[model samples]
Target: MIDNGDDSLIFAPENGKTAEKVQEEYWKVLIVDDEPDVHSTTKLVLEDFSFEDKGLKFISAYSAKEAMEILNNQKDIAVILLDVVMESNSAGLQLAKIIRNEMGNRFSRIILRTGQPGEAPEKKVIAEYDINDYKNKAELTSQQLYTSMFSALRSYRDLKIINKNSEGLKQIINSTANLFQRQNVEQLAQGVLTQVVSILGLENSYYVSTSGFTAAQTSDSDFRIIAATGRFTKCIGTKVEDCTPIPADIVPYLQEAISKEKSGFIDTHYVGYFPTMKDKIHLLFIEDCSKDLGPEIENLLTIFNHNAGIAFDNVILNKEIHDTQIDIIYHLGEVVENRSKETAYHVKRVSEYTYTLAREMGFSEEESQLFKMASPMHDIGKIGIADSILLKPERLDHDELNIMRTHTEIGYNMLKSSSRPLLQTSAVIARDHHEYWDGSGYPRGLKGEDIHPAARIVCLADVYDALGSKRVYKEAWKEEDVLTFVRENRGKMFDPKVVDALFTAYERISRIKERFKDPE
Candidate 1:
């Protein structure tokens, strides 16, 4: 250890590695004294001084104007040794004002070194200017200078750490705010990866892997690259070991973190483990972080991991609730179908057909899933119709038929009062699914675009399923017969665009029919 007086010490590397192989980071010090001897003497005395595994890198400026230029270019200068009597008697004072006010650099510790103490007295300069310390060149000995440098460097280091932590906290807040807007697990996972990287300042060369099971049960089959940035973008959705050009040892490190349920660091790479509430595991891998993995950064990672896991858990819980609601809707629709002497598969087949047609019509995956969930409820109004009219063995008379048509209005009234989106959509399908493209065929006869697009798509899907399935009043029609009816009714009974989408997805629709065949 090299002593800098007053018991302060700087320890050397224990491994005794060559200087060239072990690159040393340094604390930057700017010496802004007009006297050439002061600059040279200060560098000579502090040449061997080191602190916190770093040495001092002295930058020289012969005048205040030159110092300002250097300060403008370099951002990480830790301490400034400024001389009061520069080109002008008050040039150092003026530079201090510019640095604090104009440059907004409040972290770098400034020590005013002056030969003429009377020009700028120590008491007056300390109170008026933002300088941290004042020293007389005549009395400033080698040991005193080392002591002052040590104090200033320590203050600068602490200030920098506080600033970095503040920025990291801001990043975490912003990331979680953005994450709250995501509606699904995949989106939340991606947002968590992005925010973690932002907090750690690792924008480049990172990979995120996830296991859809508990750590104890996690295997290669359960692990997938959920979110990847930079060079690993192509690895998403693939197994970790299957990704090419990956480090051979990364998988083992990831496994260790998962099985142990903890974060791990190996050299410059860090693996963060976040166990979600669903008993699943998410691992974030980053290579070549912009900063060292110090105790402060490690603490920040721990906090981030905890919060991210909770956010992911909330998203998963919401998704499970949403899926359960959809299942309940399907079962309710099945009840209505069974009451009408229709097979339970009629509702399932209608849902599948509507999903296919919605996708073919360029609807987003989420919207298509909504259509699939809402379409099954289309005939729920039929449950309110009189049994004599709904389960009739022969064609209905005009009055009975009119009463039967009111099932659409009955179903709409039943669901329209609810505030849920799925039910609101079901209300629309119930109210307008029977309305025709050309001002005909409904209780209200809402024509053209006046009908909701969701109802329009489900209308064709329901009719297709109904005509192809056996009913109490009629036998199931042939595939060609149903197709001919759909073609004939285009623009007259159904939306022309919806009919076109149906024809486009004819093969997939056939496959759906074969898959969910009615019980014989």
Candidate 2:
């Protein structure tokens, strides 16, 4: 430990103290003074001084202008010992002011040294220059010089550490914001990995997060390749099984951490290790082949492990919610199937058919998907009808048929007024599907121009599905027969424009039929 008045320069101290060792561990210090004796004297005092196991390396500059040259070229200079009365009476003071106020050398500690105390008063010089220390050259004994150098060096080291951490924190915050903006889990995972690698200063890497379906009973882990920053041959979507096995070097550590659900850091650069996540521990892998990582990279890995796990949980929850909604819709479609002898595949086929027709009609992809989902609910009102009327093989009497016709009104009443896309389209179909272009049908009896386009489109899908499918009351018709029936009814039972659109979509309709073919 070296002491300089109120300041202490105690470096933790490496195994040995030497100028080479100090230069290797700490930022270089430059001394600017006019006197040749001061440079030699200062070096002798600090030759053995070590701060935090690091000794200080010193460079000497004769004047303020010389110091600026050194400052301009040597970015590693962390601190400077300056004299206030070099060249001109106040040149050192002016240089100190310029270094701080103009050059923006905030990180380098500046100590102003002067021998002619009368030329510039201590109080005035201290106020004018943003120097860390003010000292009379004559008063700075060997011990005092050693102590001042150590204290200034320590402050410089601490400031550098603080700045690096601040930059890392900023990177983390920006990456977290990006993660939040992502709509898919892959994107979120990518953001997390990118931030982590950057903060740790890793060269290039990839991240994988693994989790299970349930908290306790997950099968083979679900792996998500969240982020990749380096030039790896594998793509982001590549599964764990597709990649080469974990390198023999990292496999054991990874397996142990994964089994215990504990986080760990590895030193291998060629292959990265992460535990397989079953129900709990979400695994992450990073392939960083760079040679620069040591304890700093390990520190980052520890920080990232927990953050990434939480992110994976959020992604899984979102996926589960999306899948649950689809399952509920599927079961609801099944309920419609129970109302008639139509299989659940019938609803699927009609949705596909509707999507194809909408696509052929030049609708946007979003509208086509909406039509696909809504088309399944076109017959949803049949759920309200009795099996006796729905399954009757014989022709109904006029009154029985009238009650059956009320199914359209029932379907409309059940779905109308709801704001959901599926319900809204179903409502339109239920209300106007039976209406003729000539205004000779039931419900609202809307005419051609007045009918909602959604209803008109579904009318074609419903009729085509009905004609092509075998039902309790009617056998399935041949493709040619169905086309003839549709052509015969065009402009009478169906909208003429819609019939024209349907004819254009015959190829698409056939493809939908082939794609969603029934198992039975």
Candidate 3:
């Protein structure tokens, strides 16, 4: 009963009985023998047999060459019944070795049957090849044939189960290593969801959603959906109950999984609970899995959840440290501004302006944040100037102005020694922010592209804020006067590209000024 690559089912007729309808999935049996009578007789005997609610499907091949072709094309052939004497006396034995050693197929059960046992001795053949059983055709009665087949099928089934478990474990191990490479919580959660579907071999059959919240928050409303895939893509950033058209029963199970701090399964669906350090809890939901959740899959999920918990904790801790560093940068910049009789909000305005210009210049979100953090330190060099020159109410002479110009180099020297990334960026901004676009400004006299773009952006932001805000030696200028000066100095005092970005983001620039205005 070989499949001819057509969408039709073929079954051998039993004696005086109509063949039963075949199950959707059946155990495949391949018969490799030179005799036509043996193939017909074997199929006739097993046509009515069923095991584990699955019927038998037989495939026939007359020669060993044809048998190898069938084996190459089909993947799930469970048992192969090979005859000892075929085209040659040793053909069956040779094919058995090829299947196990060369093809690397250890899951299929092979049984050797022969009419002439003297041609190939039983004990020698069994020891030499990887066959599962040896039987003499004369003594193989109907009951003996049934017994032999039942035992072989049982062994084949168990081997498949073991193989599936080994593959699942391998996937989980690889996924854990990949998940650890992500640096933030949102990225880690997305990776975990992708790996869980991959481990089950149901990547396209299931939809995954993950929600996270602080552990102290008990209400379901606090659990925001941080990541969602497939049908739940639009559910991201929404609370669980607010996800419209989601099954009502699934919402309660998600809440239960979080409240109880455990995983829950309903038929093919599952919810995994992971609690991290610092009172953070993550919940993963998988829906519409095409297959039943076996004990093996459940066990794999348990191991995956445990490892993911540690990775999630590391991401949260790293985020906290990052926020603390940014705060330190803001305060250090404010201290320098305060010494020059400038309000703290002046530094805040510059940071926002730099961030806006960076975005307009096509910088990524991460790079824009770096610009915002480093821009505040552009005037840190002013700290080194003495009060006699820095605080003078009148214009400075040549010697005193030259001393004021040395602050750029002084700020660079103060911060250049630090190994931290944020401080290193601040050092560059401090040194080059005073450089002119046309090789006229002091320090390095870096012209055009020689200066870093971050420094170029901060240069405009600093001048704009200083012109608008009142200082110790001058009154605040009108908004029109500042814009006119910026436009007039486009390619001489500042980079033309930076000036263009400033105009493009002028609305946001105005909003930042109003939001952080100094106290009256």
Instruction: Name the weakest run of 10 consecutive residues (lDDT summed) in model 1.
Output: 208-217
Better of 1 and 2 by lDDT: 1
Per-residue CA lDDT of candidate 2, range 1-520, in tens?
2335555333223334234443556558798988776676566556766776777677889999999999988877877988877889989888988888888889899887788899878898778668888878656565677667778887987787667656655655566566666656666656655555555453222332221110111235534334455443243455444334334454454455557666544453322232323254444445443445545455555555555555566666776766675566556766877667775478777777777777777789778776776666676677777888878888888987887788788878887888877668767776677777778877767888787766677777878877888777778899899999889988877888778878887787788787877666
lDDT of 3 by residue, 417-488 (tens): 999878888999999998889988769889999988899899999999999988888899999999999999
Instruction: Name the lDDT of candidate 3.
Output: 0.81
Per-residue lDDT, model 1, residue 380, is 87
Instruction: Provide the lowest-lDDT 10-residue window in model 3.
Output: 209-218
Q: Which residue pairs collide in model 3, if any?
A: 215-279
Q: Which residue pairs clash in candidate 2?
A: 11-51, 11-52, 12-52, 12-53, 13-53, 14-53, 190-226
lDDT score for candidate 1 against the true structure = 0.80
| TM-score for all models, in order of appearance | 0.79, 0.63, 0.79
